[model samples]
Target: MAIVEVIVPQLGEGLQEVRVTRFLKQPGDRVERDEHIYEMETDKANVEVESPYAGVIVEWLAKEGDILPIGAPIARMEVEGVVEAASPVSHAPQSAPTPSAPAAPPREPVGVGARLELIIPPRTRAYARQKGISEEELRRIPAASGNKLMPEDIDAYLAGRSETAATAEYVDYPLPQQQRAFIYRIKRSSQLVVPAVLRRPARWDAVRRVVEQFKSTPNAPVHPSEFQVFAYCAAQATLQHPKFRSQLVGEDTLRQYPHVNLGIAVARPGDELVTALVKNASALDFVSFVRTLQSQIRKARAGEDQADASIQLLLTYMGGYQMVDAIPVLVAPAVAILFAGEAFPVEGVPHVNLVLTFDHRLINGVGGAEFLNAVAQNLENAETLVQSGMAG
Candidate 1:
């Protein structure tokens, strides 16, 4: 039997790291070739990874909640080939070491008098070390929320220290893996590309009327919302506005997708942001569209899937909140994003603000404004859109 190393494969373009969420197969469990063995969470999606070898799992190099770089060895599998290699677990940076008795608590240092007990979690300690925070400095940092010193406390202390620094020197702290990935995309999509935003108001009365009618329907498939109506209309709008489904490639090229893969922003526990992607959203009938969108959103909330590059546009609905308007970020490979805010009475007419942020490299301000107008028109005709969708 050959002991083969199973590494974390590249899940997406420019994806450097992922956090292991769960393992479908434990050590010693048998697995088939191409069988899904584990699940991981990226910056914007949770995805299952398939094992390449048909083998018995020998050991796991990474544990649940561990964030590992791509191509890092995750497991050792005994396979049917003669491929021979030494066990990488001995020195693998991300390996899961054998379980042992918990280490003794760290004793408070001598000479320095600390006002409170030093209670630091393992993750927080690691974060402090990465920040070049000395043990003495950590001991002096105050914990605002609880007895335990959290990462946030370190951030707060650092912020205050920077503000009162004696010199102009700067300190760097490593960003969380998820945040780093998000920034990477933003840098590529927004900072590198020219992004333009346009705002317009749409009447929400029609949306409310249609939503109320749907709610009154006995045995309704799903309770409709203003966001749903807007999403359906936006998806339809993409058909008429091809540029909305296109993405800039090189300096002088654009790649237009055949279908509208709409991304809906979802906030998971801890306010972790993810996207619920609806593939070919423009093709589904309104009822099917609603069901599919709801299912995808549930999966995103549960961390079951991540948004990929195929998604051409994104929709962030702030209608449930008191927000009146927001400028949404345009993630890379997606040419545009739409933001909808809460409706308020304008001269006794209830209207919601819509902001469309688009990549100027592919869409001009005039085109962006026209697209926003199309979405607004769709919103104003919510009953017709809902009826057409229900008919399908």
Candidate 2:
């Protein structure tokens, strides 16, 4: 048996480092060659990395949430092989030999290698790039901690610069990274899409019965609610209406996804709002859907999954509250949002108002009304949506 080092591989496109999001395999667990061992969050996407050698896990050098550069050893594993001495991994891009030419004058006083002395995370660099901050500008900003620059430090520098540039007549306050990101999304949505709201009455008597039935089940993996049932129905409805799963890519292109990625808006303590995502909801069974939704909600409240743009639709529930109907803000990239309000007895029949805020650019008022009707119809037949195998 030979012990081999598992290092973070080169994730291309100029990315230098990645943050570990999850560990697929733990120590002492056997893993196969080319099997995914861990998942990492890059600036671009969350990627699952595959192992190069089949081995039994040894020890992890990094933990969840740790940011490490490419070529950094992340774990060690025991494998059957005569291990040879491995050379040190280089992070710098390898280049082919070229003819020597006249050297160009340096644009900045500090070289790129000198800038590397300070440990700036890849996420921080992405944020800086979005703000049009140059390397020289980054050099001028002071790190909050020992040699490492954080996103918060960048926010402080930008706030200070904005305050300094403002006239004495007005005062400026610096928002946290999370709040600023939320505001940016709101602004971007308003600028990009033409939004419109459509509301319809959905009979909740059937949905309520389904919730009660689940409550009687012993040891249910997820507790079912009217809101969850509605979300499930909405996700399933997208199978017929493809526009609900569509997103505006460029100015003129409409891209429809094959599966439904549902976003549930969760309000945590201190009035912080986050969206918990259930990726590929339409593909999962009813029980699986509810379980995944419950898990994602817990993660969102714990500050794990924030508002993910990949979600095709968003659902905000105000059930049990006195509110009847609300016009939700249509979050961009997602063309449709559903708002479920308090259910009330109308003519001896319990009904809830479902307001759908949709992008008018992608869906017309007629299409929105038809799609919502389908969701309402789905709720009316809640027993079929929540199958008998839920307790199994």
Candidate 3:
């Protein structure tokens, strides 16, 4: 048996550190090699990291929310292999070894080695880089006001200047948990996904016909939003185009689904961006898809839980906005997302700007355009189901 160290691997470009957000396993638990054991949140993503060696966990050096640098060891394991020295343990502050010995207070002049992941704003980081001021230097200087050192703090540190209340304003608030998850996913989307956005004008005449029918019939139960209709079409298209239903699981690996989990964007209270899920959307008929989607929307508006992480395609509505096109951020695990704006007329023809954002690594512009054209063609010919009341 050998003792091995599992350390934090390099996360991504320009990233130096990550926070240990959650631990899936603890000391004494048997972990298989390549088993995910911890959730690490970098500046741009929150991802589960796998254990390198199959063995019982010996120690977990970092606790939840502890900021750790790349190559920092967070755990140790006993494996059946030739012994390899464990990665160096993180230098983050820990509790005292004995209760009788109180932990030493934090030191002034926080070391450069431990300050790589300091929380500084974009402007501050740029100014620090421009001024050749290290983040460690910021922590070394006594804060004139805020706990975090800022660009003005840098000036105060180097030039022997001071900032006043009149010239500086600071505000701090913790993000809501749901919002934080949304942000984490968005950052992953931006950093990891190679996005391709396609824009075209589509007229949802078939959708309007169905919505119009809903108005005439008293208590016409299913209120199918135009987005649902578009989603239904896109879902059907995914059944034909396997690429739209695929998710990038590795550098060159794609895991495609037999059916699509259609994700509908709904506005929730507290600035939370929730994607209400329609599970196995590709298997549903028009009416079932419509009712399920509308129900999800209603449940979401009532502050109910409907969103999940198993999204395959996203449908978002941005009505009453004037723009050339709106490109959606392709959420991770979902290769494609659709955006729709208000329908307007051009030369007596109704046209709605349809935008499709896809992961370029999994798909390309030609495939994306073909997919949108499929949705547009379905929307144009929606009268078959529209006249049938979409009851199927």
lDDT assessment of candidate 2: 0.77
Cα error of candidate 2 at position 170, Å: 14
Root-mean-square deviation of candidate 3: 12.4
lDDT tens digits, residue span 227-335, model 2: 8888888898898899998887666888888988898888867677778999988888888998889889899888764566577899999987788889999878789
Least lDDT summed over 10 consecutive residues: which range in candidate 2? 108-117
Q: Rate the local accuracy (lDDT) of all candidates.
A: 0.77, 0.77, 0.70
List candidate 1 stretches off by more than 4 Å: 1-181
Q: What TM-score would each prediction reach against the true structure? A: 0.61, 0.60, 0.60
Model 3 misses residue 160 by how many Å? 29
Off by over 4 Å in 3: 1-168, 218-221, 269-271, 302-309, 322-324, 386-392
Q: Which 10 successive residues of model 1 have the least lDDT summed?
A: 83-92
- Candidate of highest TM-score: 1
- lDDT assessment of candidate 1: 0.77
Tell me how many residue pairs clash in candidate 1. Answer: 2
